[model samples]
Target: MEKVLFKIAKQWIAGDTVDDALIAAKSAYSLRRHAIINKLGEYHTSKKQIKVVLEEYQKIVNSFRKWKIRGAISIKPTQIGLSISQKECNRNFEKIIQKARNAHVFVWLDMESSEHTDETIEIYHTFFSKYERLGIALQANLKRTDNDLNDLIGMGAKIRLVKGAYREKANIAFKTKKDVDNNFIKLMKILFKKGNEFAIASHDTKIIQKAQSLSKKYPRKFEFQFLKGIREEFKSDLVKKKFVVSEYIPYGVNWLPYSIRRIKERKRNILLLGSSLIQSHRV
Candidate 1:
């Protein structure tokens, strides 16, 4: 059952190694799409495990450089050791950032759940000036994201706006799809007006249309980002219209947890999986 489920989940994750990821990324690039590659795993307590992940990222950086792939790497704080200590996590992050910088590869800090928000922002700010290409993801569903956007705008930070996937309390996050979508547009406008560069990350046609409308008014450096497999046809149409598009490509051995979290975040994914299973059984 687990193996069958993993097969369904592979639509989201590229594969389980840098080589596999690059192959997937190359395919995307061939279609005139950019990619953001991420290795799956996070919240580690062991220093040895953290070091191992760091090493994997370094390999990713080297591969990007060698292949001349026009993409960046996304990383989770805990994957580098944020659960152990912010200081330790920062140290590990800096090491990867420095290597990426030398290789001219961008490194994006991914925002996890609400608990790590403030610390993630602080760490991003701490290194913003030192690393010019560093970027961070922001969750639009969070109630405080408006203020967070305003604050980070002053720093000229590169931000990726996501609809947010983690489950949070009513007080902390928008509870309804309508509210979340509204907030996503609101935050997108803020970034468009004030940010230096940003990525509008979503698969919703309505939100993308809203962004398209807003872009005409508040012109700035920005692009649209989507998950690798979701809405490929729409993404291609957007690319045809000359809008910059990037795909978030995740790859690693620890795909199960990531896949489970994805399903938990979006109930529709379960229906998709069931449909796929039924079709496969028919086959």
Candidate 2:
């Protein structure tokens, strides 16, 4: 039954087209949640495909102003041919940033696998050198997270910190959940101390508790971010507390891979979707 539901989840993805995402973003923004619109395909194989993806982004960036929408975008480095060449990735990123900034929006560069970490940061910082609107996401589980945070602290980068979803070797990432959470808090403390503007991006209850408790001490400095359609009850409770909150609303045609991954690791996500279905179709 779990397997069955994950299968259906793939279909829930809003597809590749801009209109599809624009509609979803409108609803998300209206709900008092900021959305990080992600157009799906990762690891493009050619420049032609990269250009097509760029055009897709332009479509969304243009619509945000046209429709008077409030949302930003999350980008995967590989989607614009990072693997093919870092230069190619930088070129593509610059194009996205130029277009997004012109529309008064922002772009958050998502950290992919470990292999692309260095080049990704290099490219991201290169952009940050020019555009303050281009932001970056950092993973707390990574061994080098602290160093990265320290080095990039003064840039005023909009960072969304996650415990990291990708499976990695024990040496490169924290093997225990406790370690990850501890590291997350430690990093959060650093960010707070440095007065860096950031989002507490996670759905973990204990971590959220720690954040909320700490946030109470400095209520005006932080915001919590979560994925759209996940952790609704918790988010509601957080909102009631008056802490700024956001939903990472992903749309676009290539969203199927995200669904496939959720199905593949259904243990973490299946319950969130299954609960709603079970409640609706109670026996």
Candidate 3:
């Protein structure tokens, strides 16, 4: 059973090395889609492990320059040092930003569960002031996101809107798919109206269509982001239409949790997986 599962997981996860990730990014470039590479471990309690992850990320930053790929890296705060102390996390993150700035690569902060939301946003605010190429992901499932989106837009912060994957209390997050989708649409409307240089990161066909319609109306600077291997055909179609698309490619040895989360995030994800498998063969 584990082997079978890993087979499917491989379709989503790039591989367990920096070179594997670079190959994935190169593939994205060949498809005429941008790449957002991520190393898939997080919530580190050990400073040693965190330091290793941070250094790995710096290597990824430099590697991006060496490969000359128009790509970015998405990092979880906890993976750096957020699980230890905010001061440590801030120090480590600043190191990454400085290196990334020199390499001319973009950095994205991946929002974790609700417990880390405030600190993550604080980190984004602190760094975004110094780094214009930084962006942060905002979860639409959270009730507070409406206000948060407004505030981030006012700060001219680049944002990536996602229907969040983490589970939370009903009071904290919308529990039903309909409610979540509705909130996602509402937040996306706000992005089109007020935000600039943002990303609509969703694999839902309806949500992608809605973003297309909103772009026609508001004409904001934005791009569509889909997970690598999940919607190859759809992404190609959008690329053919001249829409900017990015593939979020995650690579690491810690692939099980991320793979399971992709399936368990919502019931529709299972259906989407099947659709992707079929569409992938066609593509």
Give the best candidate by lDDT: 3
Q: Which candidate is the best by TM-score?
A: 3
Residue pairs whose backbone atoms clash in candidate 1: none
Model 2 global lDDT (CA atoms, 0 to 1):
0.75
What is the C-alpha lDDT profile of model 2 across 149-208, one tens digit per residue? Answer: 888886667677787766778898986778888999999877766746778887777778
Winner on lDDT (1 vs 3): 3
TM-score for each of the candidates: 0.93, 0.89, 0.97
Across 1-283, the per-residue lDDT of candidate 3 in tens digits comes to 7797788788888999989999999989988999999999988889889888888888989987678788999999999999999998999999999999999898999999999999999999999999999999999999999999999999999999999999899989999889999999999999999997899999888999999988889998899999888877789899998999999999999998888888888777667777787877875
The whole-model lDDT of each prediction reads 0.86, 0.75, 0.91
Better of 1 and 3 by TM-score: 3
Tell how far residue 32 is off in model 2, in angstroms.
1.1
lDDT by residue (tens digit), candidate 1, 161-256: 998888899999998888988998888888877889999998777889988888889888788998777666677888998888888899988988
Better of 1 and 2 by TM-score: 1
- The global Cα lDDT (0 to 1) of model 1 is 0.86
Report how far residue 71 has shifted in candidate 2, in Å: 0.6
**Over 4 Å off, model 1:** 269-283
